[model samples]
Target: MARIKLSCERGRSIELDTARTALGCIDFQADFVLPEGRAGALGLPIEVLLAALPAAQRALSAAREAGMFVFFTRECYAPDLSDLNAFRRQYDVAIGSPGPLGRFLVKGERGTEVIADMRPRDGEPVIDKAGFSAFHQTTLDTVLRVRGIDTLLLMGYTTQCCVASTLRQAVDLGYACILLADACAAYDPADHEATVRVMYSEGDNFGWVSDSQRLADASQSIEH
Candidate 1:
């Protein structure tokens, strides 16, 4: 696959091809983005997550309007814990055995479901993933390849974890990625800003970075 290089220089105007691009919302489930969800109950910063909602919604809507393939991802595991990684198991156990959220993203649990505001539409796929990267043990790559997607616009909860992980892997897999900075969040504000800075600093190394409004505007604009 050939690389579609774009400078991550500040104020650069990016031309996104809808037919070759897909918008991926990563780990936007209730458990991670909601104020009363597991992350909040565990004392992680819920404010940042809440602040990201509007931006995420705007970007998602724009992606849909632009006729891009929209993919939503949630990090989930089997109820039997068979799919749980050792680190996740340790983290879950540390968090009081998942408390009321069903052991760290157990499938079919209410918390595992995508938050209502950003729920998948009729034919969109809600890819269930077992780890941070959507491509890890998941069919995301196949899905994108089958759809002929070469570029990805990504946004979702947790800037430093799932979102970052997916972006890095996507670049390695030959996908041009643009991470919507304002549409994702981290527990710590410092971490959130830092991650975005790194992504934007590397040009096409990991991926490019843009704010939600800029991406939304680009997506909604006419390509011709």
Candidate 2:
């Protein structure tokens, strides 16, 4: 595999060609990205996530076109916070704060629903998680292995947390990981930039990060 390395600004442009399978789209919900979700309407850049919707969809399409698996993971706790851990339950998030316990896009909540822009295609994985790491309590890893998935193309919200956590685990599991930098957003630019810097500078310790276009190009060339 010819690994492409970019500058630090861009995960050092590490070119990793692996037997990639799934594309993990995290926290792509209305309350997190749309204006009507309360947060976006308040001028939060977390709301600006919708801006990346088109690119995310494009990347997803490309991955699908390449015959890879598409997976969606969300942080949805039980109604009584039964499934939530101390970290997520630390604060009392109101119903609309984008937190699963306090309030959020849960299993059947309209707010928890996947944004219309990035609807799940047929046969894609619509996974559910309660913590920062999707593989923690969920069947994500086993599911991926069952499908023979190796490489993971990650995209989602809150770059410093969920996305970063997932990246580290993916690498530790021996699965090649590629972060969709442009396709993902965070509550703040500082956090987003910090996460990306760590992924590249930290290198294999945290997994690799890549841009949407490069991933799209690679997806296009992949022979299913």
Candidate 3:
């Protein structure tokens, strides 16, 4: 477990009114979460599962009920993963050609679908990204702007990579971002802690960070 060494880490109740929007990203895709999920994927699926699906759902539900402008994003390119950069293509080959994961998430394919239990509602939008950051190629910012969203609540997989990248950019773009420190999972424990420490060190201006339970209660209370 990653213990908090920073004195600034404060626990708070949830308050939804403090922000204009909340965004949740890549919540343990089946291709990346469950074994059965990768049944027909083209590439080998993700490793380093956190086995915390239930908690993630609760956090998501809290965000939704709080009436925040809930949003979601995931990694998937168009057919053949062509929308992905060349580096990802090379990754596909190494993971094994014709693998289920590689074949799935080929954009427009059923395999690329978000995990069933946590699928977004009709009103929610899913941003497709080839690279790590959801803002890299997608019009997420445009949607955020249109929706009058200025803050985001992010959670998901691979804490050190995509999650961290998303956090950094979200801050850079002038949006208030709160990361559910426990709601996310990563490939390595050290990497996870390192990422959190780095983000925390970035200072209070970057955003607030907390555990899923704190955020959940806050959301339930519609508290800030």
- TM-score (all chains, Cα) for each model: 0.89, 0.83, 0.80
Off by over 4 Å in 2: 1-19, 41-43, 95-105, 202-204, 222-224
lDDT string, candidate 2, 97-208, tens digits: 4442225645666667778888897887778887778797889998999877787888888678888888888888898777888888888878888887777574445666
Give the higher-TM-score candidate: 1 or 2: 1
**On residues 122-182, what C-alpha lDDT tens digit does candidate 1 reach at each position?**
9889999888899999989999999899889898878899998999899899998888888
**Where's the lowest-lDDT run of ten residues in candidate 1?**
1-10
After superposition, candidate 3 runs with Cα above 4 Å error: 1-8, 11-19, 37-50, 90-96, 101-104
Ten residues in a row with the worst lDDT in model 3? 1-10
Superposed model 1: Cα runs more than 4 Å off? 1-9, 91-98, 202-204
lDDT of 2: 0.72
Please give the distance, in angstroms, between residue 133's alpha carbon in candidate 3 and its true position after superposition.
0.7
- Candidate lDDT (C-alpha), each: 0.80, 0.72, 0.65
Model 1 scores what on Cα lDDT?
0.80
Candidate order, TM-score descending: 1, 2, 3
Give the deviation of candidate 1 from the true structure as CA RMSD. 3.3
Colliding residue pairs in candidate 2: 3-15, 4-14, 4-15, 5-13, 5-14, 6-12, 6-13, 6-14, 7-12, 105-112
